[model samples]
Target: MNINDFYTTRKNVFDKLQSSNTATKILMSLLMACFTGVMAQVVIPLPWTPVPITAQTFAVLAAGLILGKRYGALSQILYIVIGILFVPWFGEMTGGLDIVLGSTCGYFLGFIIASYFIGSITEKYAGSRKFKRAIAVIGVANFALIYIPGLAGLALWNYLTYGTMLSISSLLFMGLVPFIFGDIVKILGLGAVSKVFLPKE
Candidate 1:
């Protein structure tokens, strides 16, 4: 083949690969970010904190289940990035690092990491028909990941004195107990919902 022709073919191949990667990134980023935003509106507003709880659990769990580990993480990171870009896609239509500085910042960050961890674990157990088991794992992982970081963030943000039971109790009342049952319901509901959406692989 002529050198020019060979060069042209190689360039075309390279362009195709680049296009494919871009398409994959777009599919993973825009689609998943939109899904997460929609889930935020499906809310159950609480009187405790401005950070209303929502079906974000479903979005987080489904991200990992459908997209797997790396893509799932990318999807969540995209959601956060877009939210920070001032789109107000998060809970209560809130956005920016101001939300991050709020009481639920740790949980906000935890959501992304939890999605990755759950996705990684679920991807491994995605053998034959271990779907329920995988969901259970994801649920527990999501709960702990959100709860621990959330509580810590709240306590630290308030600067609760170590020996002050009132501060400790306030933290529990505000952070942990109110949402415990709701979160459990969320875990079970979202886990099952994810199974329906996830491909049987």
Candidate 2:
């Protein structure tokens, strides 16, 4: 083939490849959001607390590990918008502004922040196949991010509406204690699964 013709053909092929990659990323983000919504349905209510145990933490961490910071956080944002506007995809199949502004609002906000941080950390170290321990440590740290906002939201909501202030110990008991073991499992699971899926530089 002529040199100019060869160059033109190569350019066209490269453009197509780039387009495909972009489409794949967009599809993955949407799918991850949907997966999170599905996870939200796997809820078990606690008698003493308003928050329920669900599969969302696992899905959130997995999304971060697989999609990196920007797209991972985007997926979570999409999930939150979907829950608020259309489907009852939040825990217990509940949704709407009421839920978003209710006692669990902090946890929802925490999800976005944690997803971004987790994805950022994984992309930085895990992407190069170095400092694998960073992934585990960051994953655990992100759990605290989720809990901090969650507990604060719970306490604030109760105090504003019921004139009852929950002590630090009470907040921890309701928001953190019951969930620690399960969240630890989720973090470790994310680390294990990241090894299988995260790309190496």
Candidate 3:
């Protein structure tokens, strides 16, 4: 088969995953929550920053792209709520109210907001295959939407924990700089498979 044929086949397969059914959407939210939970387990702690490198970021973005705004946000809500209620699927198999108010909660908020934002933007591309546009939006959502809240949460965590004032540059180096490459990799990977999750009118 030719390249176009391969692309079409792959597109069709993934496109089938998008559904308008309420039941299906509910199932998707649960499935994505589980997926994020599973991905959260792959944590690599950094010495400089408390934020670990987990594939959960990728999973979170994927859930938004695939499930669209409402269900996407719902998925993250389920993930957070269940984790807090004692699912123990959070990073390092830890969960509870402490995690909610902990240093990383901002990213959890980011995940929900980013998912909703991504899903909303992707909806605008319903019938079109605008690869560059999709990538750009994904980049914006991942970098801006996620990192803004994340940095705030991290800084708050540091202040609450250390009682020391830090500079903005210090916050970036600790919370943002280390994760730039990883998020870029995720953006490229998701952009490449844009046909799969990007909406089809």
Candidate 4:
């Protein structure tokens, strides 16, 4: 075929692929999973806890913020799927079911639920001119869904009971306090990054 004919042919194929729902879902899921894998690579070890800080939270936030609720949850679920069935995509290492049985499983699973909530809230506020509302939803969702559950898992693993672990002071020091600053920074960064993906609505 001539060069122009070939170009047109390729364009038509690309457009057709992009228009397919399955193609879109697979593409977005892979993109988010890749981001999760990459984010897990940048680990910041901390002395106080086995759960060291990492950019994986950034990936989690972005997955939710950009993908919205259903797709965001699907992306995280896909990450778990790939990690279990294929390669171990968890931070700084790789393993099978043992990874889930380890100390970090709570945080890992929490990312899925958290991403859905964060994405949902962000979707609502996205169309409003009120950046503050967007910021608030983003902040609350990240803190409540991701951090709270994550740290609670750690606390429970440490043998802290539900009532005690859920206490304000207990959550503050064990979960919220140590990570608040870091979470804030991540939230801000993710918010800025989100603007690139979310349309001007």
Candidate 5:
């Protein structure tokens, strides 16, 4: 019930489906992208920070764990592209190249990286007996990937637009401090959900 076991189990499932279903895979990927957009709408704006608390990160984690690496990453990539070009599916239902080039852009890029990281790790560890714990760990790792870029992006945008360098303490306060507990809840929630839904091989 470690990474090797998980990889083998996933390989078996994929091998079974490899024969006649490229279309289903494509459809599912698109749906995951759409699902992320929908999740973005469930947002609560923070008074102090430009970033809001949204369900999008949970959706991103779910997509990666459920869809596997390639499709999971594709789903997020599609979500980002759609937001940048045509959809108001980002936080606060806002989008366009302006938003993409805005303060939160780092987090958007992080979503893609996080999705790939989560999906890849999940696929690698599919057969682990301690599935729930492993998923929780994976979720935490992915969150770090998301937040690092997010904080950096915020600082970068601020500097470029206003010529003011944000202090490390200020960045942590705006980007990481308020959300610590919430993100912990999300990691645990995803772990519990995975325990119920994923096969423990």
Candidate 6:
């Protein structure tokens, strides 16, 4: 098929998926949740902190772009709930309710909210076919939304464990600093390719 035909084909498929029944939507969300779990397995261990580098953020951001607001958040929620309630779907092959108390719990919480941010912005801007707009929307929302809670959780965990909160500098170093390079790469890469990824209008 020609380039235009390929895009048309991709759009038709996405439209069908989006317009499917409630049951299909649930299944699609579950699929994205499972994808998040799988991506969580892409771990890069960091000895200094509980938060390791992983591609979960990449997948979560993509979920919002592809699934839109409602289903994107559902996908993240399902991933967290399943990890807390059932399986070891988190990075480093870890999970369960006890994981909720760990240092990275804030990041998990951030993931849900970040999905919403991405989805909401994506719905508004993706159809515009504006390349820079896509980058700005996804990059800003994903980075800010995820890190705000992520750093908060890191600080809180430290406080609960040590009985003293580390300085903001320390939290930034532990939770945000280490991931900056990788996060930017992911954001730029995702934003650049987001048009092909998002459901076409």
The candidate scoring highest on TM-score is 6
Model 4: residue 113 alpha-carbon error in angstroms:
1.4
Q: Give lDDT for model 3.
A: 0.83
Each model's RMSD to truth, in Å? 9.8, 7.3, 2.5, 6.8, 4.6, 1.6
**Model 6 TM-score, all chains together:** 0.93
lDDT of 6 at 116: 84
TM-score of each: 0.75, 0.83, 0.88, 0.76, 0.86, 0.93
lDDT of 4 by residue, 37-109 (tens): 7788787776656677677777887777766777788888888778877877777867477665555767777
Which ranges of candidate 1 are over 4 A from the true structure? Answer: 1-22, 127-129, 160-166, 194-201
For candidate 1, the TM-score is 0.75
Q: Model 5 residue 104 lDDT? A: 86
Q: Between which residue pairs do clashes occur in model 1?
A: none
| Candidate 5 TM-score versus the reference | 0.86
The 10-residue segment with the lowest total lDDT in model 6:
125-134
The better candidate by lDDT, 4 or 5, is 5
Full-model lDDT for every candidate: 0.70, 0.77, 0.83, 0.69, 0.79, 0.82
Ranking by TM-score: 6, 3, 5, 2, 4, 1
Cα error, residue 160 of model 6, in Å, equals 0.7
lDDT of 5 at 36: 95
Query: In candidate 2, residue 191 scores what lDDT?
Result: 68
Determine the backbone clash count of candidate 2.
Answer: 0
Winner by lDDT: 3
lDDT of 5 by residue, 16-45 (tens): 543437778777888999999999898888
lDDT of 6 at 110: 83
The local distance difference test score of model 4 is 0.69
